[model samples]
Target: MVNITINGKIVQAEEGEMLLSVIRRLKIDVPALCHHEAVEPLGACRLCMVEITKEDWNGWSKFVTSCLYPVEPDLIVLTHSDQVNEIRRTIMDLYLARHPNSPEIQKLAEEYGVLKTSYEVQVDGDNCILCGICTRICDAMGFHAISLVGRGHGKTVAPPLDEPPPDCTGCLSCALNCPTNFIEFSDQGNKRTIWKKDFEMLACVKCGATTITREFAEFLSRNRDIPFEYFETCDACHRKETSLSMGRIAAWTKEAQS
Candidate 1:
């Protein structure tokens, strides 16, 4: 166990666990962007910066990304110091400058007391902050479909050349995990469109609900080398169907009587 002092309170934490875990476990209010429990932390937003003072260090405390920093014994951490707050404000302001109209970024700016930034706003680009959560989640899901395109300020989230690759299964994981709502998907007829790729959806036989993408279903089956015939059924319809089929002899007798 690692013993650390967070905001002057002593806490015991596991070694190598992220400092954000300790801070969150202590119930300290810290804003997080580009962070989700299911996905790996990228620390791209820099919103979780906190002041840290090592036990043996003589220099001034330094700011670090709490989500990426590992917990260490005898470490002293401050989550909401003036320096930490200023860094958070600056980060939020920069994000706001890039995405002034985004409600999510606007809310964070308002919460962090940053009404606006002196930097010029680029209007022609999308509101994505380049946090890479979408790309990371897609990679984690084993589909290297979407990615951060271009370089520096010119970068944006999309599949290569704004066109989805053949490997894309339209799983929608990227759109689902995006923090800035920069990704969009649509379903029309039997086609689901995302990342400039269209996928055929498997409709549930009983309820006609679109269950999953045909490409994604095929990927899962082929990757796992398993046959799962029920993938075409949505959960609700599947449950209803399984319940009806539970007792075939009784169902036959009931149907005959009816």
Candidate 2:
């Protein structure tokens, strides 16, 4: 365990743990858009930047992204210092300029007191903040189906050759995990569409409701050692069955005791 001072409060944190995790553990309201526990921290979004210094630094403090900075003994962290707030506001201003249409960005910027961007706004811009969360989640799901393609302004998340990803199982991990909700997918009855690809969804045998794509079920069965029949029922129906079985077990136990 390492002891560190956060906002003038001494707190103990695990050595080598990221500062953002510790800050979150303390229930500090730090805004971080590109952070997800499922993947490694990329520090793509600079919103979680905090001022850090040590007593031996001669009163000099440096700004660092909390998501990437690890906890060290006697480390001092200022999560909401004046300089840190200004830096976050500047970054939010740029985000508003780039993603003017994104409600998420707008709301966050407003909270940071960045009502209007000083830079020119991209009115036709998509909601994608390019935080890379979607792509990272896709890779974490073992599907490497999409990635940031091109460079600079031309960069975007897309499949190979801008075509439907052949490896995508329509599992919706990328879409669901996206911080900005940029990825779009539609479900209609037993059909699912995403990234211009169509997939056949599995219907629950008990409730006749759509559950997951057949491809995802098959993949989980093959790789995770789960039986494919497990996906035959929806989650709600599975819970119901579990409750009934537990009730029967309790009754059997009571009768045996008597």
Candidate 2 regions exceeding 4 Å error are 243-258
Candidate 1 lDDT by residue in tens digits, 127-232: 7888888888888888888787889767777777775687799888878777778788898878999877788998877777886898898999989886767687
Note the Cα lDDT for every prediction shown: 0.84, 0.94
Instruction: Find the candidate with the highest lDDT and give its number.
Output: 2
lDDT of 2 at 210: 86
Candidate 2, residues 199-258: lDDT per residue as tens digits?
999999988888789999999999999998899999999999999999999999999999
Cα-lDDT of candidate 1: 0.84
Please name the candidate that would achieve the greatest TM-score relative to the true structure.
2
Worst lDDT run of 10 residues, candidate 1, spans: 155-164
